[model samples]
Target: MERIELVKSIEANAERILEDFTEILQYLRSEGSDRCDEVQNLLFATRRMVDLIDSALEIYHYLIRLKYLTADTQRSETAESRDRDKMLEEMFRELNSNLGV
Candidate 1:
């Protein structure tokens, strides 16, 4: 898939993970001490999900920065190209005038 679509998918998944994590926390809070082992398992799973979400978010930010930097570089190159073209045109005009053309 495209870079933009990939970035959006990562963001959407991260948000869903956060929502699921919230629900897990709420369930844990309402549970009794009888399900200690289950609670522990859930906690571990939630921790892993948190780590994964953090990584996804980091990647999303990096992609966004890369996109902007690429755009800026393209703009700078275009400006340089325009300047070079103008300079060449001026030089040709001077040469033609000298030759009485």
Candidate 2:
């Protein structure tokens, strides 16, 4: 209900999405690249989406930090950056499994 709590919830959800994205991307590169043009194109699109998301989140975090540091708000939470190269070792639902990995 509070502002901080809402941001925390969003951050938690984003973490899960990031994890899934990383797993799916890795699987595609490892075993799906040679499948066909469709898979390759899809993978490229997904990667671009993820990159954009990361950049946007980073900017969001920076703006938040700036506002709080400038005494604009009492609620200040640092958006801890996730490791870009991290991998999720959990099983992910097959993304168009028939197409490839």
Candidate 3:
């Protein structure tokens, strides 16, 4: 599949996961402390899932920015293009940090 298609798919899946997590959280709240241990475990798993989804979304946004920046750079003059190139390098560094790479 194409990159944009993949990003859209990931975003859709992330939205579904967040919706499910909200439903589960509401149910757990209604249940009170009767299943404290199970609730805690589920919360931890939900947190991890959220973190992963957030990372995926961040990367998706980074790709979008990179695409726009590249297009802008291509249309710009030499000095402006150099500045955009620096910006692109900074964006890559930021992305790498976000991915812990």
> How does each model score on TM-score?
0.61, 0.36, 0.40
Candidate 3: list runs displaced more than 4 Å: 1-35, 77-101
- Find the 10 residues in a row with the least total lDDT in model 3: 25-34
Query: What are the per-residue Cα lDDT tens digits for candidate 1 across 1-101?
Result: 45566667667767776776776666556655667866775776677667667767766775777688678889999999999999999999999999999
lDDT of 2 by residue, 34-88 (tens): 5586577577758766765775576577556655655534333222222222222
Q: What is the lDDT of residue 55 in candidate 3?
A: 59
Leading candidate by TM-score: 1
Off by over 4 Å in 2: 1-35, 72-101
Residue-level error in angstroms, candidate 2, position 43: 0.3
Score candidate 1 by lDDT: 0.74
Cα lDDT of all candidates, in order? 0.74, 0.57, 0.70
Q: Which stretches in model 1 have alpha-carbon errors above 4 Å?
A: 1-34
Residue 61 in candidate 1, Cα distance off native in Å: 0.6
Best by lDDT: 1
